[model samples]
Target: MKKTVRLILPVLAALTLAQAAQATTPSRVVQGTTELEGEVAKLGETFTLGKQSPLNFTLLKVEYSVGHVVIGNTVYSPKAAEKLLLLHFAVHNPQRRDVRYYWPDLKFTAVDAQDRNHPYAQAVARDGTTERLEINLKPAQKVNVLTVIRVPAGGGVPKLLVQREAALLRYDLRGQVQPLPKAVADPTDTSGATPLTQVPAALKTFNPLERFDVRLDDVKFTGEALNGKAPAAGQRYLSAVFTLRNMEPGGGRYAWSDFKPMLRDADGERVEYNGLLLKASRDETAGGTLGAGEEVRVRFFFALPANVNGQTLTLADGTGRAYVYDVSGVR
Candidate 1:
C-alpha cells in the first residue's frame, strides 16, 4: 500500500507542474497591443505606457486629455474648438544621428471600447503653446511631444494602435480627459527680399538648379501637336517636359504643387492658362506619387501672347527660393 501511494503522489506532482506552466505561458500577439517586457528592438513587442522601457528609446510617460479647452496652469487648446483627444508622450533619442519626429509618419490610430477607430486629429494651437509634432532631435535628446486626435463626446478607455517598422505598440488611455481651446491662424508676412526678376542669357535643354531631383528638359515651341486645335484670338501654346528621378532607395513623393509655375512674358506681365485640354496638355505632375528609382515624364502647357518674343518660366518653392528658366526662342 505504501509503494502504491508513493507512485500516485509523483503523478499528482507532475500534473500540478504542467498546469502551472500553462497558466503562466505568454501569448505572442502581433500588430494589436499587449503587455511587453525587457529588450524588444527585434522582438516587436507591445509596451504599456510609462511601464516597460523601450530598447530603442525609453517611453517615459503617457498622458491623455479630452474636450476642446484643457485649462489648468496653462491652456492646452487646438483650433476649431472641436472635441479632441490628446496623447502626450515622452520619448528619448538614443541614436547617434539626429532623428526627425514627424506625426504623419508615426501613423497613430485610436480605438474606443465601442470598436470605433479615431484617426489622428489635425489641430493648430491658438497661442502656439503646443509644439508641432515635427521635432529634430540630436543624439541622446529627450523630448515630450503630444498628438491631438478628434474623438467623440464620451468614449470609454481609448486604445491606440502604433506601428513602427513592422512592430506594433498599443497604448490605452488611463488618465484624465481635459478641454482645449480654438486654434488661431499664424500670420503671413511678405517682408523678405524680392525674387530675381531676370531670365538667364545662356539657356540649355535642361537646367541643373533643381532642389528635388527633378529636371526641366525638352522645352521648345511646337504647333505640330496642336492637331488643328486653334489657340485663342492672340494666344499660342508652349510645351515643356519635366523629368523626375528618385534619388533615394525608397519611393519619393513628388507633386506639381511643389513647383508653383508662373510665366512672365517679355512685358513682365503674368500669363494664365488657356484651358487647353489637348492630349499632351495634361500636367503630368498632377495627382501622381513618384516611385523610388523611377523616372517620370510630365508635360505642361502654357498659353501666351503670340507676339511674345522671350518668356520666363518662374518656378518658386514658396520660400523665396526661385529658379527662372529662359524659354525664349525655343525651336
Candidate 2:
C-alpha cells in the first residue's frame, strides 16, 4: 500500500500544476481602447457572466493591471447579466522566499449613523494558518486568487462594499507598486454618496410606512466615495446599509431558505433584484431562524439617480409595512 500511494502522489502533483497553469494570466494589461469583454461590466453599463456564476459559487482570479478585486454577485438588478464587474488585481511575488496572505472572509456587518461597528454578520469564516492563509508564492512569480461572492435573492445588502483596512493584500513587489498605490474610493465610486451619520436617518426617517419593524434594535448605513459626482439634476444611483433586530418575529424555529429583497425605483418601479452590498439568498436565511432579540445588518446600494427616485422600502412581511425617508440629491 505504501508503494502504491507513493506512485499516485507524483501524478497528483502534476495534475494540480496543470490546473494552475490553465488559470494563469486571467487578464492582460495592454495599452488600447477602453473595452471590457465577456460578462465583465462597468458602472452605467449592461453585461453578462455567461453560465459561470452558479448559485452560491465563488470565483477567483489574478490580474496584472489592477491589484485586488472584490465584486459581489448581490449588486445586480434583473437587467444585469450574470457576470457584472470583473475586477483585476495586479500581484507580484518578487522574493526568493515564498509568502502567502489571506483575504479576510466577507461578512454581513452592520454600521450605525456614526460609522460605528454594528454586530450581526453572515455566518462565514476564513481558514488561515496564523496571521494569514497559506498561499505558496514562488520567487518572482505571481497569481490571482479568484473567489466568488454569491447572492441568491434576499440574503444581501442593497450594495456590497469592498475595502481594505491596512493594505490587507500584501504586495511583495518590494516597493515597485509605490506610484500605483492602493485603490481608494473617491467621488467616482458609488460609496461616497452619503456619510455614516445618515444611516439612522435613512432608517428612521425613511420608515414612514413602517416597512421595517420596531423589533430592530440595530440599524446603520455606510457611505461611498463619490469621485464621479452625479449631476445635481440628472438621475443618480444610490444605496445604504441596514441592521435588523429580532427580525422574522412570531415564527417557530425559523430559517430563510427562500428570502429575497424587494427594490423599486423613484416612480414606484420595482426592480427584480437578487441581492446587493452584502448579498441576499435563501441560505442567508438558512441554518436557523431569527430569535426574539437577535439583530442583523446589511448594506443597501442601488440605482436611485437624481431623476428616477424611490421613496419607500418594504420587507416581504404579511403586514405589508413600508419605510419611507427623505433622500439626498434630486428625484
Candidate whose lDDT is highest: 1
Query: Can you write out model 2's per-residue Cα lDDT over 276-296, one digit (the tens) per residue?
Result: 334221112223445543644
Which stretch of 10 consecutive residues in model 1 shows the poorest summed lDDT? 185-194
| Residue 279 local lDDT, model 2 | 23
The TM-score values for the models, in the order shown, are 0.34, 0.24
lDDT of each: 0.49, 0.32
Give Cα distance to truth, residue 6, candidate 2, Å.
Answer: 99
Worst-scoring 10-residue span by lDDT in model 2 = 74-83
lDDT of 2 at 99: 44
How many residue pairs collide in each prediction?
10, 65
